[model samples]
Target: MSDTIAFPYPDYLLGEHQFRGDDVRAFFAPGGLFAEGPIPAKEIYDELNASFNGRGGSRIELIREAYDSVTFAAAYGAYISASTKPDDVVILVGHSIGGEKALLASKATLSAEIDLLATIDPVSRITTGFRKPLQDVSVPESVGYFFNRWQQNYPWPVDYGSDGRIAVQDTASTFDDQLKQNDIRNAAGGTKKRGCTAPDYLKGFCKAFSGTTTTTRTDHGKLSHDDWIEQQLRNIIGEKLEARPTIETNYGRSVTEDDAADQVFRWDVRNHVFSWGEQDTPSSVELQVYREGERIPELSGEVSPSGSVDFNQYGLGEYVFSITAHAFNSVTIKQKVIVQDDDSSGPTITLTGPASRRIADSAPLTFRWDATDESSVREVSITATGRHGERLSPGTWASGGAPVSGSFSFDAQPPGNYVLSRSAVDDDRDWDGSGSIDDSSVTSSRSTSFTIYDDDTAKPTIAFFTSDGSPLLDDSHTESHGIANSVSWSVTDDSGIASVDATIYQDDVVIRSVQVGANDRISLDEFGPGDFRVELRAVDADSDGWVGDASERISSVRLTVTNAAPDVFAGGMYLIDEGDLLNLKAVGDDVDPGDADSLRFDWDLGGDGRFDDAQGARPVITWNDLVAHEIDDNGDFVIRVRATDRLGASSTSQATLTVLNSAPALVSIDATPVADENDTVTATGIYEDESPADTHVVTVFWGDGQKSA
Candidate 1:
């Protein structure tokens, strides 16, 4: 007898379907396929169990109905109790849902030695609502040899059968994509419908047909007893399994076999270069140089028996040197390198500004220059001298590299001659073949001279107006009701105005200033509600405002900005009778709290959209007069209130007032006397009302007892 035993478990509901029919006669009958002749799977298990006198030492256990609770629990408990031994092969063969139970069984019996675990198209427990589908469970780690074969060609719509696929994923196991035995090739030769062919009734019943049905009855039920599955079982029993191989990254070595980091540089003052690859290896090495983190390498080359790569002719920056050494396998190593500057010439500085020997005394002295170096310049400085040829106390300075340019300014210089000078210094570094000058620390300077003169120029005259062609009647002050305002101006200067500028002021504080002319206009878009002033300054060739003497003028009008409208809030509605003195309040408030009282309230009693009744600036109003025309069908009317601020800015609010109908009146009431305790007593009354009500309830009470309504 074979030392190993196969504990076969059939899938869910199909276990009996696959094992109990003539279709599987070849699977049990001896000499047909197994050579041992007819023997049921359970018979094999029972014989093995009885050999040990039912003491529970069985070579095989056939677990059927694995999807059923009772059968599965009993089988699982039995498998767990069977103590497993080393060198003993416990082979498990499960199909469909039975496959799920096999995995569960293995997991439950942690100590059981599973030499081989094979599965057919394992499906989930159909009766258990598919809570844990057989397709989702993975093989337990305790199993040694795992084999999974499934189909993937189930017919459309009726995809209940295997599609030639299984969810069991064991990367180290024997996985085969086997062709399902349900094919027409495996079916008995016949003209009648069989195998992949569907019955005429089935074909006609379906709306559309795509060839023969893949789920032929012969295919689904005959899989477990098929010739191919039997051969797999035989193969497992014969111990014909292939070994799985693994790949390695670093050849499983604790230390590298190459020297890379210590090989690359040759630094020099004027020029430098990096070289590597002196040692020879079994295989050629590949070198790549990058600036680190960057995918694209700046330089790349291969290392042969006698090859060295140069790493110069580049800008000054940090770079990464990477070596990919190849031998029986490959390995990577990285190193960092920094390239320093190498230029030795002093940067040249040039100055340019007012070329005239004399400039307006009121105008500022503006000087500009450019500095450059072959490699890099560190700093630049500027100096000045007075008319008497005395050097100025200090100078202006800037710092940067080649191709740098900037400017410096001096407020209106006193009427005198002055000289402005500038110089640039290169970075301190010595270079080979740079004459006697280290170039680093070398400096270069330049200077220019000019004089300031006083001039006489009068302030410019200005005027203001609205974009709508309305002149400020006061000429110096006006008020606006909206944020959008237009201001137009014109200026005149005796010395010929070079340009005109306007400055806006909020009360006494300056807000913004802009250059303005006859063709230009100003919009106070950002100006909130407030009082402001606009001042104009015109500069001529003498640089009046550009210097100390500013020719300026102010608007003749004070602009009172009341752009925000007052928010109106009418009080709650009320129901009142005619001739009643009703008090109502329609309050108004401007954005600026102080302007709240400066609002006029207007009332539209009938909500006719017209404010015919005006209440000056009073927010509270008393209404005693109501005309019949103001009442609608429901005895209701809307009262709208509009509030207009002193600047004419306005907003509106409204409320509805509903009138009530006359109350109901009782005409008379009568009561009937009761003769016995069980006798009924009645109370009745007559009433009238101008309004309509849903229902009327009446109640009668016994003087010494209860009442009903």
Candidate 2:
């Protein structure tokens, strides 16, 4: 007999069934202080029980807390020592705070051994300052295999603070010392622990034993139910169960090697026959076949003891066949037969396309392919990838008719290096002959590379128009100064218009370049009076590196800008006493050379927009000459200046002049001879002021202390 058993069941059933009366005792412990409904620990326990004890023959327990874990582990150990065989498997899994308790239970197993010990994100309240130390947080030597998973950044709720709110603490690293000592070998034959030391807050446990430390990003709360952790547990348990022995039993009797010797069966692949020896002819025989994961009823049935089942109607690929035979002494024998396809030939394809061509001159590029296969063709797909490895949408084609050849075409594409790929599939893997191909069908792919070059040779055309959309001829345009004179233009090209730049030039010298849009006005107010020219250069949006014709790339209009109004600088405010002479000066300049030397100036002293008070660049006048209507209450007069170019274009400016009033002076006093003190005396004084707008009051004094006016 073989020392170890190899069951032909699926992976999920590895540890679920009992073989040779072996027992799998599994213990699970959850975190948190309360045993709530549907906790992670209970869920994990249910799943593991379903996997390990699906036949209701194994022992599994869910411990709610650390105290209960210790009590249950001791009790279960006693039970194991009394009833379990030497080959039974013991598994212990714990999460969060319960992980520490599980380690303590490992040590409490005494003479019993734990086949597998798994801890996920363990936390210690004593090390985190929540309580006093109670037990050793280390892996026991009694553990045959250890798997540890941990995180050091997720927070856990602790006691409430003084503010009446629950506080959280990062206790993920509370068991670092225990983890460092429990490091084991990884799948690569290297140590799970890193060589360098990390800080306490950043330290974590390594998830080794089964493989290298997992790098999956997980938190403390989610580590208990993490998919990686659950898968690791299932894998370790499955491995342990598969390494044990298998004992064949009949109705209440054990089957000896001799009793099962003649029940052996052999599958004949070439003949599609499943036949067994003739030793079990005293009872019944059963046969079943499964394709993919489901059974095929037409291909499975009961047969005679020495009979052979035929599978010639089935198609290619893998199929699982199960056979059972019962002997006259109630000895039952079961076996599995796997039939796989031996055909190796796949679909053949030959793809063809152009090597290189210009997108502008080349017609629609045609792609053709011929596919041939021994089986019916299922589908054919095509894809195109550009220069930057970006995929262009060409759409996929699928057909059930299984065509052997096909052709397609692509319109003119952008200039770039492209790769065209075609793939064909054949329906050769229909294991049950259902006319539908399985995912394991034969597929063949072929790729061909091509390049599309840009060959745009058309230059952009520029057309100038006035504001009213009328065509404006080149060199026949005249624009007035001091007014907004604008022109519009349109640029177009066969490829596309990239940019249209407008530049202004004065006397063959470059001024400034401006941006222009279609039908948008280009203002000429910024240009001074001169022989100016406006040029527009249009560039096509061709992506090729070739520079096409440049002779007709630019269009220009040479026109004469007429006279510009002279700029006037009127002298600033002036202050003079009444009867003092005031001199005023003004300066003028014209941008047009023809009008520069002939610029004229005029002034308006009254500030009424009429420059008739004075003429010439400089004028002089006395303060007293200013009319009363011209000088304001503050004795201020505003003077204006107007500058005119030779073409009669004029601009005006102004300044203020302040005049001070002069005091009246006494000229002469005339008095009649006053012989007596009571007689009336007459006195008069004459005053002359430079300001004619001022009126004066007079007073006279007599010799006897009485005053008369």
Candidate 3:
């Protein structure tokens, strides 16, 4: 184990150094938010430190956190610069956003190499509108190995429908190509409350034991506190183990020791031979054999130069053999061999039922076979290979006697090509004339193959792929309106895709539908003032001729459809006298019958093409403010009103507003007493008026409302 650790932010820093009252209260007071919770950064640092503290290495622990990308890089670089010492084993671990920040810190420290990097759902609340999901956190090329583990929170809703931590791909190098292991599991307390368990065999020099350390809980934050995960990390740093020698046991089944560690190996033969090898095996080695958990050795001795041991003298029971070599340090190769008292020769078996034929997965399949042996058939094994892949029959071994026939019923497999094979073994083997069965003369029959097929169960996937064959994101823009838009779709299935049906919906109502086979483009030309939902449904074409229906699968995308323009009509021409108020109204019509109330009306009083004002359904225009540029013309003002639908579709209508001039009205009057006028005396007066015709008329008015002209 090496000493040195890094974390983001030390809450203890505020309490111990800053002496903040709130921080002290939260750390020491009771009934606070972190009273029993809140595993502070310092605590994590201390816990990791205890694992490698006295192990003898230069100790260094650094912790900090910054939200700004620039500051984050600077802080991370400072930490890496501090760890410039040679032979430094850097173990980086973080939780939540800190996990992502930790990885970023490693990425920023390009010159540093990481021995182990682990993360628990690397996530962060995007404040800068720039973020990488957990899935986007690629393992640094310089990191020796990475372990990414995340437990889905309750409700298990992925962020943006993406659980970035499920698997890491699209990195500088393939995740499979890197020395890393990615594991994701649902937290206990969700649909399936299963606890997290580490693999039995560790990777590199780490040994991860399989055990339960915590009960099922919905708190996703507890993953960082998971004792199992922490213990694995501790083991990786503190309890590193050297690689062990490989051992295998072959008895009709080639079973490797790694595959069946500490498992009982059932042996029915009278003799057993063990072969072993090591990287630097000495000329001679000691082998010890014991019976089930016994310290006293049942047998211990040195074998010849060859590393083979026979156990024909042993009786039926459980036995453990330990082989030790000087090359390995304190690592003993142990094998638990369980010998059963069933030494027999294998019998000959033949399949009598399920002749080569096509069947549906829902249908029941019956397998019949005959087994014959001179001594008596003991067991029969049935196996199968299918189009989906090869599969072993559930409980393939069955008990039977010589010249016996039996049948087993099973559900049909998914659609694919398949081959079924069977073999049998007899109850007795060839005896060595010493009242013992000869292990070298075991009886077994050659396996025979038969063809059987089941209907395809996979449904075709419908993808709205681009020209390069990538799926289209939702609400993608299209320029075609009332014209064909390029729409490409493809359906995939394990079996061949039969037919695909594409449909367009306007506001959930089906508008157009067509059939497209295999890979083909269907033109979508639905035009209206509503949203569009394009759906593609597909079904698999099973060539097995199975009599069962394959359900259709569907994928769809929604988009906004541009609205068309509405038709506007203004009332016919109207004449109004000067100073007389005139009102003009315009009505509009739309192809979308439902958008009548949402239509907007605009009026252009000058008929200059640019709408002056927008109003409700009806817009009123008064001729009082009307100015006639051409008085010699018709004195007609072309008032235009435009109507637009909700989707920006518009139309305009024009009407003439004729203004008529009234008779001249007296604006002013002036009279001069040129001569004294009384009843017929000469009098003169001048009157001013506003009218198209310029003229002067004189009239004299007497007292008492009487006028003379």
RMSD for each of the candidates: 33.7, 18.2, 28.5
Task: List candidate 1 stretches off by more than 4 Å.
Answer: 1-283, 291-299, 341-363, 368-542, 545-709
Instruction: State residue 639's C-alpha deviation in candidate 3, in Å.
Output: 3.0
List lDDT for all candidates, in order.
Answer: 0.51, 0.55, 0.51
TM-scores of all predicted structures: 0.23, 0.38, 0.33
Q: What is the alpha-carbon lDDT of model 3 when measured against the actual structure? A: 0.51
The residue-by-residue lDDT of candidate 2 on 1-709, one tens digit each, is 0100111111101223232123766655444433334422233335434444445666554433223445544554554345445666877665554555556566676666777767655544445412113223446666777766554432332321111111112224121212311233322112233322232135453344355444233344444444434433444565666531223322233333234233322222344554554342445655566655467787666766555556555544445544444321222233333444554466788766554443433345667778877775667666667678866653544433324676655544555677777677776653443345333356777777776654555677788776457677767787666345566777777767777788988889988788776445676657656777778888877644323422237888776667767898888778877777778889888776557678888888876777777788888865544653356233777788999886688998888888787787788777785557787756555777766668777766656797655
* Cα lDDT of model 3 by residue, 1-709, tens digit: 1211222221221122111111110011111111123345455345444533333333344333444433554576557646554455565565555555556666666566665666654454343211244455556676555666554443222342234442433344423211111222221111213344332112122222355333333233445455445434443443223343333333323333233365555555445666555444444455667655443243566643235666655545576666544221222356667766565445667666555466555455666777777777656655555556656454553323322576655453444566655666555643232233233334454443433444455677766754345566777653324333455776788777777888888778998898877677755443644667778878777644344546568878775545567777877686876555556667777766555667788777655667864455454443334533222223566777778877677887888778676555555554554545453454443443333333455556766698765
- Tens digits of lDDT, candidate 1, 295-331: 2244675654334445444434465655555432234
The most accurate candidate by TM-score is 2
Off by over 4 Å in 2: 1-271, 276-286, 291-308, 325-344, 354-366, 372-403, 410-432, 437-443, 447-591, 597-600, 605-610, 614-641, 645-709
Q: What's the C-alpha lDDT at position 465 in model 2?
A: 75
How are the candidates ranked when ordered by TM-score, highest leading?
A: 2, 3, 1
Give, for candidate 3, the lowest lDDT window spanning 10 residues.
23-32
